[model samples]
Target: MRIVEDLRAELGDRIVTEPQVLQAMRTDRSGWVGPGTPAVLVRAASVADVQAVMRLASVHRVPVVPRGAGTGLAGGAIGTEGAIVLDLSGMRRVLEVDVQNEVAVVEPGIVTDDLAAVLAEHELWWPPDPASRAISTVGGNIATNAGGLLCAKYGVTRESVLGLRVVLADGTLIGVGRRTVKGVAGYDLTALMVGSEGTLGVVVEATLKLRRISRDPVVTIGATFPDVIAAAAAAAAITASGLRPAALELMDAATCTAIDDLLQPSAEYPVLAGRGAFLLVRTDSAAAADEAALAARLIRHAGGEPEVSTDALTGERLMQVRRSAHPAYARLGEVLIEDVAVPRSALPAMFAATERIGASHGIPIPTIAHAGDGNLHPNLVVPPHLAGEPGHIPDVVWSAADELFHEAIALGGTLTGEHGVGILKRRWLADELGGDVFALSERLKAAFDPLNILNPGKVL
Candidate 1:
């Protein structure tokens, strides 16, 4: 209470201890479990405000949670008891854009889509287009090291970031990385900080690497397979054939039905209806048409019907459906989103295992994948009637999810591809890293925040 009074006195209305506001800031999109509500909410307007909050929280040895837009799939943005939620979504500003040097300096609150729009003006682009980019913040993307459809050709958020302005646990502001294209100075702390999940320090600003927008004509290929295995095989064959597409994605039978039923019940949107598996492949290469033709042929070889399109509208509609897949499921029931990734070659195995797991667990799992990269999001749909009822805990659902995670690890893959290990997956992280490596990770956490004040109970 004294801390609240002090914060309100110093920050005025910027520090919100109101019950309603605190309740709203409790958790992010990962609604598997409700969060322990924090006592203070600081809507940070500038770097100086963040510094002030961090300084006070450090002095009092209170936990601090940094949140951006609350679009994160992981529970990384969930606030804990007695903590201060440092909301950075208010600090939206594009500080600088070095066109010649191919870099843009931005505030943490800037939305990914908004930044892309600004970049378009300079004929430059940022490729980390996560499905939630329309609402996800640049800071959140960096925290998760997020990857999207284009990640197969370009890379994740880590690749596009060059420098970061961070605020340490003790409220000390420091710049960790360089803005130049190549810099091997000291340690590569910038890379370390990118996916730290706001545990090591808080990101205030970033200098991001930009790419020039491609002028070559792009082609999109949509295909349907008899089963997910066939689609995945086609993806593998495409990759093996050395015909790299700009983006390659897959939606399983149940997912295709769900999307079609939700978006276009009367008619098929993107022609995804009545398909056991759907694949969308896009290429912006110099030989874009040739690559698309080859991809279509590969689809045929793998027993799929390919639908080629050079029209931007139709292709974009296909992509829009893929992006909207996750949210669309939320309308049906309690959607337990699972992020598991395996080797591209082992994709067929992953698909098979998911089917077996779902059958065993008696849960309906609809999966969609960035097939080119082997990242799959399996939506475990819990019927509306069964949700939040007494003794109806979705432990049965997680039992299947447990199998999915282990299967991914066993197949030389990770429990999470783009999403970070927040509260949702921390239980499995130790198993993935082994004891020795897990201990070393804990040491890194200790070295950064001796008091464990920054985003406590995350990552490590």
Candidate 2:
């Protein structure tokens, strides 16, 4: 397209049209499958630059795929065949911090953790922290309406957003939502942008609500069981007890082994080799008696051995091990990460079905979960050497996971809880949402992007 020629001249050598550049940006952390090359890559600096690119794409009838740090696990930032990748990573900035109002306005490329660090200096906190917070951008989180460990109490990204500045497909910039505590706003476009997955418009900036930073003492609880089903049962029971914990996580035997190898833990029994899966639950309070007693009762009822920890450093160390799961699994093989979620009661069945799927396919699928919120991550380890063949173990494991994905939908659950449905889950989206719902979503997409030049073939 001649638009590529215009972008090259406008953005100078920063605009990359080379084959290798296209290849690198076309895939994300999910690694579901490689994607087709984008015709051009425009690394935008200022909002004006973004406006220029959007205007050109609109005029030329070219697709524009908006991208942040490329840390997305669901391929949300991936480009389509012969499209323009509007890379927003260069626009990182803290535009404004209204400390009095308890809000911060930032550009889309600002990392979640970085924003948290800045907020920490002011004794403030932004609570929507996904696992990839250190690398993922605020815009990506807004697109997916991400949920995280604290979601059981704090809610997801949707509840935190107060205002948004979105650039529509036709290059119209509209501000939505109010900065004040509450308002009966018009259609609530700010709410609509959350979890839209870039199909509607580009999120240029956001004003997010903040909470007071706390230094409360934390109590950690560790519970082990012979299988994932028992642990899931314990998780559900703990939530049912009404004692909300800071974090409720589960790690399978394989994952524990991976963590042990990576951190070289000196525990008497390796974290994984304790004979089964374990639950790591944390509460951000010094009053551990209530939380600890509830956890113990639930764990025992679910057929688990429970241990409550009051030591801060020891609990922190164990939480570190839990957070290291993804990187450790990456070292073992090519990772096929599934972010499927089911009802709280359906978790035990989901775990059982996952184990059966692995065994049936002769593939070992180690699992983990943010159990408090019923978000399950079943990582399928694919050995690099065996990649690309139809008979590869990774491919087999992925097929099994696909079956589980459909099963979750059948049980009135979603294919993804936190991770957005990028190209990886595009085919099954209709199956989950159905024909009429899908058509309504498409009509909304058309209303916002009449030219159909924004992140084509992603969620529709």
Candidate 3:
């Protein structure tokens, strides 16, 4: 199409059409989805540039995939055939920080942790911190309503957003929500777009509500269990106890071993004992006595052995271990990550079911979880060679994943908790939303994007 020529002339070197460059942008953190080459990528530096790209795509009836840092796990950023990649990584600006009002206005490309750091200077914070916060963009977080360690207490990214600047499929720019804390404005379109996964509109800017930054010392607790069921039981008990922690994470034996090898190659299990599956608990407290007592009591009640660390630096370092749990497994082999969630009450059963599925498939499925939120990521590692081989391994991996996801649905849960139904989970969406409900969703998609050009093949 000559439109590529137009974009290249208008965007100069900012537009990339080379095969290698386009190929590089085709995958994400997990690298498990589309390998479709985009016709071109427009590296938008300003709102006007984004508008230009959108205007062209709208007129040409070309699909445009809004992209941020491309850190999505569910292939939300992957492009389809002959599409335009509206790259926003160049618009990384913090527009406004209203400390008194507890809000910040930022462009789509602002990195999550960087925004958090900027807010921290003014004594404010954004709590939805995905593990990739260091690299993921605000736009990606908004698209997925991304959740993380603090979601159990502070909620997800959607809760922090007060407003959005979205570009419609027809190239119209509309602002939704407000800077003020409360507004009954039109329909609640702001919330609708928050987790739309780029299916409805392309988010350009957002007004985010922040909380007062805390200097309260962190308290760390570690509890070890014999198996995943016991580990899940401890997690449930902790939640039932009514104590809100800054972070609650679970790691299985394989992941723990991987982490131990990287951090302390010479140390044995005694150094990092409580090994089968463990929970890392964190809290903000000023006194050691209270945090210590709470940890000890909960661990004993849940049939666990407790290890507590109240030193600030030490506690932070321990949390790093929890944050790196998934990546640690990636070092071992090719991974198919599963973000399966279930009702809090079904956590033990879910954990038991996962173990059973893994054994039945003969695949070593290691797990990590934001347990307090009932979100588990059970990763099935495949040696690249084995994945390519024709055998029960690939069949087994897919079967185990299907069983786990179906079980989550049967237990009154959704297919995914944080990751959107990007191409991977599209078929099962009807199973969760029902036929009529999913039909209505498709109608809504048609209503907003009649041409169906916005992130085609994503989320119905």
Which candidate wins on TM-score? 1
Error of 3 at 236 (Å): 0.4
Query: How much is 385 displaced in model 3, in angstroms?
Result: 4.9
Best by lDDT: 1
lDDT of every predicted structure (CA atoms): 0.88, 0.83, 0.82
Candidate 3: stretches off by over 4 Å: 33-35, 265-274, 285-292, 383-385, 389-393
Question: Per-prediction count of colliding residue pairs?
Answer: 0, 0, 0
Two-way TM-score contest, 1 vs 2, winner: 1
Q: Write the per-residue lDDT of candidate 2 for residues 1-460, one digit (tens) a residue.
A: 6998888777787688888889887787776544477899988888777888888899899999999988888878888788899998877799888888899999999998999989998899888978788898999889889987677668889999998888888888888998988998588888998998888888888999998876776778888898878888899888877878888898877877787787776763335564478898888766666777778888999899988888877787777777788888887767778888888778888888888888887666788888888888988766456666421335576688788898888777889998988877888889998899999999999999998998888878
Model 3 error, position 231 (Å):
1.4
How many backbone collisions does model 1 have? 0
Model 1 bad stretches (over 4 Å): 265-268, 389-393
* Model 1 weakest 10-residue run by lDDT: 384-393
Candidate 2: pairs in clash: none
Ranking by TM-score: 1, 3, 2
Cα lDDT tens digits, model 1, 1-460, are 7778877878999988778888777667766444477989999999988988888888889999999998888788888889999999999899998999999999999999999999999999998989899999999999999998889888889999999999999999999889889999899999999989999999999999999988899899889999999999999899889887889999999888888777874433665667889999999978999999999999999999998999888788778888878777877677778798888998888999999989988889999999888899988877565688421337787788889999999999998998899878899998899999999999999998999999988877
